[model samples]
Target: MDMKLSGATFRRAASTVTVIGGSGFIGRNLHRALRSVGARPHVFTRRKPFAHAGRVHPAVAKSDTIFYVAGSVTPALAERNPELVEEDHWNLNLLLWGLRETGHRPLVVLASSGGTVYDPDAAPPYREDSPTRPVAAYGAAKLAQEHALAAADWTTPVILRFANVYGPGQTASAGYGVIPHWIRAVHARETLTMIGASRRDYVHIDDATAALLAVRAHADRLRATPGPTTLNIGSGAPTSLDELHRHLERAVGGPVEVRREPARSFDRTDTWLDVSAAGAALGWSPAIGLAEGLAGTLAATRHTSMSP
Candidate 1:
């Protein structure tokens, strides 16, 4: 919604950072923010990973930070296709091995899923110490990814379990990103489908980027913190599907038709994260309100649709 850094700039610990999926929603936003702060981020995508290095072996060379934001599928997709989910796990392991082979001891920041990485039976405001009982393949994969990173003793791992992060650069396709999907539908003057009554804690993209940077800035401090530290990045405010619809209506300046459907087995109800750990650890807290974030998203969507 605003400039990521917002005038207060700090020196980066690393000269260059490596983003595994630099072109994706979060990755792209983080990449832009890092550039604004005068840091070089070597982005690795499937098409252009080793273009400059000539091979995969040297791709991670000289990078001081590795931000792992790439993933293969949505939660629903992963649930329907366990084979593909397993394939993604193996692929992530291969990338980890490659990083190890390069002998680069970078601070590894894994972008975990806060939405699916916990037990549905657990109470609201999920803490870092909460038990993880993933009901979907996507959450299982994220938990597995966190474990895989932990096993790599050569690197320092910092996991950020992000909540429902939505903003301008998000997409409605691929059966995920509900907020952006609904915004896109509203922008097109189409009916908004509501599948089950569920509540989620949404963190704006600007706040998400700020949290990532805070982790990078406080890398050493987090490493010194006793146990396997994983902070939940969320707004700490739970918004129900109905409330979200009202926000969308206000953002779009009209009432959108709603078609209610049965809740899917993969969806969680009344889930939000306890952001205290992040505030305590990284000195970060979400500043944008739900209404403001939704308006910003709608404006960005309109700008994109009218472009070109």
Candidate 2:
């Protein structure tokens, strides 16, 4: 299949990307990517502005582009505090609607949940056509927001169903990233307990960013094409828990003790995304596998630690 960015698909000069939830893990990385591409990125955080404070918290005016990767994880938080989820949905809609009200046709990119987006048994190696049955409250919330985005049109909207994104500079104790938590435990010389088998298509941060950027580069096709475009970024290979432990051990050579526990009901034994659609549509594919991604992330983190 051929993928080209030209004609009606491409919109001209949508600079000044406004990133909502720019304080989150994926948002930070994506913000960097946008800047690297010479796209002026406006990071909208809830905190009192610092750094480029003038440009940091710009009003929700439709300008260039918008990448929305802000949302909460943890099923318990969503379950116990449904109001929080409702509030997020409300704030998220208002933000997007504000953008729509303005004449800014931003190539809005949404960081959706790949793990919880689809049902556990909704066909192994889920395709984009697979039926979605979210088991977790967070996934349902994301789905609702996705629908809202599809409805609220500005210019172009792309939904990135990101797999479990893991890398350095992540806080494991916050209880989100599995890889970061495991890496921290190993680094701190603590024991590790896994909920279920480690089988998952762990896409490296670099690969995920690259795929998303490719979408930006080809925004025209994405925009001309009717309906919201969803792409899955992953290694397309399931790395089981048993396999993950051994791999981490080999890489770090640390005292990585493991104890088995009852897996969370929301957890699946094995899950991975069928990335062929991304390959065919975006000319994007995951370059780094689990072991390679882990190695690179470890090296970077250790280097940061050893820096003077």
Candidate 3:
């Protein structure tokens, strides 16, 4: 697909942007990117995000664009504490309600999970129209969030079903953030545990940020429309655990000892995403490959670690 959009267009479109979870892994990078594109972003986030549904201050009702990235590390954490899963749903529904009540119709960009939304038993490269049979609590929560957005009739929503997003600022010790976890283990020379042979479609943060910017640039048209539009954001390439270990080894310039463990029953064996719709709709495609993305991630992580 032909991916073409000028920077000036993005600047014009992203005049007033709002990010709910601006401190998050993706949100931080997105906030920075939006600023670079000459957009004024209002960030709304609590000091303690996992505590409960932090009230959405009425001040955010003026934003023309809103990116909903505020949610727990649900993939690994939600299953343990089911109560936290509802926090995102409640917060979003309340936020939408508040926006409508205040007469604000911002273009909402939701971060959905392409990795968990579809039934793994059905197919490999899951599309936007695929049947949503989330097997995990996190996936179920994400699906519910999608439904809530659909129900919110005030504003237009662009639901981006993201794959395993990995890049700088990704936490290493949360039982999630596999890429960062591996990088940290390599830096510390710790044993790398190979839990399962399951493959996942990993999308770099740069590409994800670019897609968000594109969506923001088209926010006006997207909001003018009535229904919500969903698109899959991924590299469309599946990488196995063993392959990821090898990539990490190359990135760290050292050997990693793999400790094979039993795969979890909830884990999907092979999963990828079809991003053609995003390409066609947003005029965007992933420019960074996995190898280069890993290198950039390692470089950024090292820089962060060495900083005072």
Candidate 4:
């Protein structure tokens, strides 16, 4: 999807925007995109940990919108160390308190997880109104943040339950992005590891960023709505491990090695999203298909590997 937003539209949407956790994967990309479109973006990293409300108050005081992308742990990591979950909640409360102290009720957009925040046994293609039964600590933490935002009447909350988002610049971290990890493994001629027969709905980073911009552009309507707006952001298509392997091989122009492992206790068998509401609400839909996105990511991975 195109990253450029019309100047007139941005002017109408917001002037000063604050991105918490601006150094992370999604936040970094969103920060760059916001700059490209001529919005004044203020970034607050986790380096300081937002310990003092005085420090965060100024950053969000006059902002028209705030994107909360801050979180300490992934699902797998959170499972190992559940203490991080409490820390995550505390950090958000600090941000909320800062906003309250400043008396600024900006449109707050939260980056939530669609993969972990749904009932695993309910059904596939979970919707915004679907029952939330987070099996892991990470999912529970995200849901807690959602509840916090919903309870904060001063701010307009827009919770985006994002499916697995992968694209260029995503690092090959453990328990993070399978696509990037597999692509890196292919480049290095290493074995691609598969866990069980899990399937996931992957959305491109461009599409994810576009969805955030769409929320920003629709800030007025969202604020005018009765309550907090929660929407799913994903491709709405599930791809199994075998299917992803085929696509990756095609993208790289060769076959790669593979190794299968037993599924972890925390892993869900399948996860897809029903993104129709996000489409209807924000006029947004996933533009990059899995194959196309994989190919682009492969090219990027190759370039990055060769870079000095």
Candidate 5:
């Protein structure tokens, strides 16, 4: 899984691109990669939300490809404030409306949730066609978004259900990534919160970015086929909370404190994805192992802390 593409490959894919929500963890990395590879990318951030007015609609109208990575709520946030979920769905509808009004048929790639969208009872390593039964509002909203894209016959949709993605540039915050939260806790010498013996498939940001580019490169092939193309993007391996704690301890050269908590009713016990379809379709697989990725992230966190 050497996830490197030459500039010529990207140039051949598309001349113009639009990245909705380009300020977030995944979008920031994807936007930078596209620019580095000589692709023209227009970004829309939360500070300036996309709307029918102004330059937003125009950018969406003329894009050769569009990456919809805009999301406002995490599982915890969604559970606490369900109204945000409705707002998210409304925003997506607005985008779809703009595309239809302009008659723009671009390749639209959606970043979905693989960790929450699968049925908790139906075994691990869920596939694209696996039974979807989201226990939380976040997963339900994502599934709704997927359905909306699938129904929109005007644009070509490529739905990517991603596993728990973590790497450099991800910061610790409420209702955000668990890995970063734990890393911050470890650095601050605080107790790492363990909820319900949860296990998940964590993919590095670099690998996730590579998969997005692969989809872009093969956009023409995807558009030619009928209906929306759905795929799972992940490492296809599961890691437990205890395993991750040990990895972090080894990286920092000390024992990390731990605190146990009962699992929330909305949480899933364990989940991972079967990413063989992505490998076969896009010729992409996760290259970074968990231990290696975690070590690199810990080093970056240290550097960030030491900086002025």
Candidate 6:
């Protein structure tokens, strides 16, 4: 069976886009954006992605552009399984060999965590140039991978240090997402817990992908010029967990019960972002507000979520 993108799509997907772990939340959303631009996205994953099973990699590394989005989050996952995380990050470097043979150095977009890339105390909103003092295994691993990409001689490396991303279809389980968790807790009549009330800049995935595509538009110019550009893609304003909860309540149309858990020892007090570089460089800024984004996400979850 021929497993190629359609003829019309071929024009846009000419330079095959490989998104490792593209089936994951961030990657799936990014793939949607890539398709909109007529880019054929091959999701390199262990399992077939929901809609694009054929695009699943039986053997990838032959693709043109490779976006590495596979990694573990949650402190427990990272703390208890550091070796697996390290291996995943290390394997990304191996892509350099295949990328080298393609003749065209594919544009590489790394979905790094903006909320943890820099020390919270150094600046009001974290910047790429800010002093980085990652306190968790997850942050440390991402930083090390960024260093590896820098040294790997990648054709064009754009590091998107992303803020806490929340939108529809985001997992509301114990592992991730602030808004959905609240929605679930509210729906379940469980407790909505806030740890440290740590402030963070939240970017809707729609806005996040817009920021990424903006960077891609400049990849050619960026490749000709040496130097990997590190950008923080987020809304500059910081919203406290408490504030986010208030917004969540309004969006869900409810007054949910609340509980405060003692701040985790590893948790950063607050880590908003400074997106000036992305704005100045890529001319991208997040347009979705908290309540509006959350409201949309809530409606979307009703349709897409398994539990509802």
lDDT of 6 by residue, 1-308 (tens): 01223343344356666777777788888788887777767776657531232232333545545677776556546667878777767566666544555555667778888876687568667778889978887788788888877776745777889888888778776557567787777666788888766788888888887776666565555667677878898888899988888887787677867888888766777788888888887667788888888888877776664554
Q: What's the TM-score of each model vs. the native?
A: 0.92, 0.87, 0.92, 0.96, 0.95, 0.87
lDDT (10s digit) by residue, model 3, range 35-136? 776677778677733223444564467677788988875577877888788767887787777777547667788999999889867888998988889998
Lowest lDDT 10-residue stretch of candidate 5: 1-10
Model 3 segments beyond 4 Å from truth? 1-14, 48-56
| RMSD in Å for all candidates | 2.6, 4.4, 3.0, 1.6, 1.9, 5.4
Give the CA lDDT, 0 to 100, for residue 193 in model 3: 75
Cα RMSD for predicted model 3: 3.0
Show where candidate 5 strays beyond 4 Å.
1-3, 6-8, 11-14, 53-56
Candidate achieving higher lDDT, 1 or 2: 1
Q: List the residue pairs that clash in candidate 5.
A: none
User: Between the candidate structures 5 and 6, which one is better when assessed by TM-score?
Assistant: 5
Checking candidate 4 for backbone clashes, the offending pairs are none
Q: Taking the tens digit of each residue's C-alpha lDDT, what string does model 5 give over 140-223?
A: 999999999998899999999999999989978787767999988877878889887888899999999999988888877888
Q: Model 1, range 79-161, lDDT digits (tens) per residue?
A: 88988778767766776666665665667888999989999888988998888999877898899998998887767788899
What is the C-alpha local distance difference test score of each model?
0.81, 0.72, 0.81, 0.87, 0.87, 0.72
Candidate 4 TM-score over all chains jointly: 0.96
lDDT of 1: 0.81
- Residue 157, candidate 3: Cα error in Å is 1.1
lDDT tens digits, residue span 154-173, model 2: 65778888888888776675
Ranking by TM-score: 4, 5, 1, 3, 2, 6
Poorly placed runs, candidate 2 (over 4 Å): 1-14, 48-60, 305-308
